[model samples]
Target: MPFTPFHMGAGLAAKAAIDRHFSVLTFGIAQIAMDIEPLIGMIRDADVLHGPTHTYIGALAIGFAVILVSPFICRPILRRYNYEARAMRASWLACPEHLSKGAVALGAFIGTLSHVLLDSLMHADVRPFWPVSNSNPLLGLVSVDAVYQLCFWLGAASAIAWLVGKYRHGRENG
Candidate 1:
């Protein structure tokens, strides 16, 4: 699923459930990070689409990298979005510039790990535990159609939940 929006569904659900403890921006960055290897392979017509980058070791490395750099990358974007949200009176969409390092790390890890997990189910070439063994035990754990449906429904449900929570909070404050 190169460049697929389906990878974002888990991140959306996590952000909705863990708001302050989940950085959607960091999660998104990790998702992109995970796919970079695959994208490179596709462009070069390499035999290995899912390489070492799809492994848990790779995820840890990518997650740590995101944690180190996400604040600098996300702060400005979040500030701009917050400014626009404020101008539009859409407080629910507003974001803060200061995100906890722990939260960013958590989100990044979740994003990378989930990407590996989901892709492992559909992609026979993904060896999530690469260094341990080349075999992908998780391949075909679920149908590709089921994976798509799950991702879509999870994203929809989480978005609705987040909106409702934001609306309720606004009402209470008002």
Candidate 2:
């Protein structure tokens, strides 16, 4: 909600829990995709910061775009990542291989959709159901601090899960 990094907590949790079914990398890209509208609106001094891009329709479009693009980007990156982690004796840091198409789609959709829902909680201008209802009933349903805590706790839990997994697999570095 504050920035893309804030979204990583949920992404990491999803990746840790779902394993091969989710990709935090693709989710990060999708967060960027969802935020592009707000970034531009802020830059141009537009009245509506979280406009169309913070809607289900907009998220679907962003997800599709990410699905189409992530493979090309994530594959090469993961190849190098796998190699480097192995070299560093931290094989758990590596993904088995590049995420599958389904995983990419899952991550993209989850990232974009969750971004809208989370922002809707704190931002008044975010009409998550825009063009249909143009109302953000979910707005302020939860406090901003609560959302931040949720993110922090989810990230911590994911990190703990990852560490437990790494050591269980006997691949933890040091």
Best by TM-score: 1
Q: Write the per-residue lDDT of candidate 2 for residues 44-133, one digit (tens) a residue.
A: 998889888898888898999999888888888889988999899877666767578889988999999988888989999988887889
TM-score of 1: 0.96
Off by over 4 Å in 1: none
Residues 1-174 of candidate 1 have per-residue lDDT tens digits of: 778999889998998999888998999999898899999999999998999889999889988888888888899999999899889988766666899977898889999999999999899889999899999998887899999999999998998888788778777875
lDDT top scorer? 1
In candidate 2, how many Å is residue 164 off?
1.9
